[model samples]
Target: MSKRKQNLVGYLFALPWFIGFSVFLAYPLVASIYFSFCDYSVLKKPVFIGLDNYRELFADEVFWITVKNTAIYAAISLPAGMVMALGLAMLLNAKVPGTTFFRTVFFLPSLVPMVSLAVLWLWILNGEHGVLNEVLRMVGIRGPNWLGDPAWSKPALVVLGVWGVGNAVLIYLAGLQDVPTSLVEAAELDGASPWQKTRHVTIPMISPVILFNLIMGIIGTLQVFTVPYVMFPGGSPARSTYFYAMYLFDNAFLYNKMGYASALAWVIFAIILVLTGIQFLLARKWVHYEAGR
Candidate 1:
């Protein structure tokens, strides 16, 4: 066959994927961007409105509420999850007895189906009869109504979200395994304390993995939906759990404000882009990539 024929054959093979991308991903993205600038409802033809949707979105009280809630969730959950995962990974990295069993125990929660996990957490955090509260009662400590009260609701969600950090733990563990033992041995021979060695050697070596996990955690927290939605469908006790994605979902479907939702989604996309870019910029100072690896 001629080179041109071979090239045509390759293009034929790639056509399906190209078509799928154009139809599903690229087209929808472009459409949403356009829709965000118009006045669109599913039942009505979209009319170009020139940033009216964006202006209205900024003025909407619920938009600001959802932003505050999402920001709070991201601020609290991301660091807590990352720190917990790193600590767990460090513990599991130690050559302790029954480490495999403990690792399994820690990771099992992440494998639970989302619905099942939500239900389980609902029960566990129930104020009146929860196992957690019951234990607190035994210790003569009063347990707050976690999901019921607006003040405590987001924290409850954060706790539930942190339970699934097992994946992060595994990633950190992989990074830990890749750290050079030669550096560790040198630190030990230099009579470096355990904390000193971990701070100077292990952490710096695993900085790239830490950066990866941090960025992912930030994005995940920003787009948190299922857990909060399932736990508090009505936004619960005055919209404290009404996160950005949930608000966007309600605007798109429930409220029949497709344009507004599209605008909200674009805003979210912008926020994620900005935050992720900031992380990458800051990572230049900390994330250590080894030579030739």
Candidate 2:
């Protein structure tokens, strides 16, 4: 095929995604950037109001609270969940008798739709008549109201995060498959124990994959909305599970503070960007890519 024809064909194939993105996603993003600077109340036309929305961000007490809650949730969930996932992956990699069964069991939760899973968990973690609390009772320990209590609500969501650890485990499993067998034997010959082999060779080789999952996990956690939004009531039971995205949604749709919500959106995007950048920077010290010296 001629060069021009090939280029034209490539563009034709790419056109659908480009058009959908521009219409559905890109337009909203650009609109939000403009919306962030306006005095929009959702009932009236937006009026340009420079940095007013941003200034309010600092003074906004609830915004700061949401930020803190979100940060705490992410800090608690990300490392813990990844560690759990890595541990599970390592165990699964050992080629157990029921490896496939365990893999299926682990991955079943991620397969379930988010709404369905949330509703199921709601009942399971209910203050009374719940299986989890009943199990606690079996152990002679009184269980707290998980969703109804503010202190336990966020932690409950972290527990829910376990359901999706299967996906991370799958990624780690793929990385494990790529690990060199010769390297393991060589390390064993050098008197390295199984722990040492994994610590030095297996982990370093899979560090890039680990880093990929970490980045995705961080971004996913930051934008977490549905699980908490559904599991606990929206901004409910003293607003304990009111995630940052949930708060942003409430401002825009429920409260009619469109401009402020847009401002919140921009801040979220910026925060994610900064956090991702920091991860890449810090990964230089820890994430061992094949090309890195």
Candidate 3:
């Protein structure tokens, strides 16, 4: 084909994707920005309202509650999940019998659908007659009401978050496998114990992977919705389990506050952006990369 004809053909091939992007992703994002500054509902024409939505959102008690809940959940779950995943990854990386089988068993939970996982955990964490409580009773310890008590509710969700760290474990396992055997051997030659070697060598080598998982965990934990929504309907037990995303969803759908929801979404986007920037800045201190990386 001639040069111009070839260029036209290429454009034709790219047109579908360009159109889809413009219509779906780009348009919705732009529309949301406009809607955020208006008094909008699905059934009514949006009326420009300046900063009213943002002002109202800031004053909403439930908004503050959801923010606190989300922050606390992320603070607890992020580190806990990362540590658990890294530990499991290290264990799986070791040469042991049935390692593949154990890896598969551990990873299967992550493959389960989120809704199904939530329902399954719902049964396990039931205040009475749950399998966890049953096991605790067998050990002569009474298990507290996991989903019922506000004090324990967030912790229960944290347990659920930790249970689904199989994906992170796989990522960590990859990083572990990539560590330089020579470095580990040098540490051993220096009479470093396993714990010392892991602390000094393995972790530092895998710092990049740890940073990736940390950023992902922050995003996921901040937007936690489906699991908690399914397990703790309406953030019951006094809304202690209510989170930012859940509150946004309720505002948009249940309360028909699209403008407010849009504003809340923009705030969420800003928070994620700022936090991610902070992580990138702090990563310079510890996230090491090989030369030419």
Once superposed on the true structure, which residue ranges of model 1 sit more than 4 Å away at CA? 1-6
What's the CA RMSD for each of the models?
Answer: 1.6, 1.4, 1.7
Lowest lDDT block of 10, candidate 2: 231-240
Off by over 4 Å in 2: none
lDDT of 3 by residue, 37-147 (tens): 999987899999999999998999999999999999999999999999999999999998999999999999999999999999989998898999999999999999999
Give the TM-scores of the predictions, in the order they appear: 0.96, 0.96, 0.95
Residue-wise C-alpha lDDT for candidate 2, range 79-158, written one tens digit per residue = 98899999988998886699988888887878998899999998899899888999999999999999888889888889
Best by lDDT: 3
C-alpha RMSD in Å of predicted model 2 compared with the true structure: 1.4
Q: Report clashes for each candidate as comma-separated counts.
A: 0, 0, 0
Error of 1 at 89 (Å): 0.4
Q: What Cα-based lDDT does every candidate model obtain? A: 0.93, 0.90, 0.95
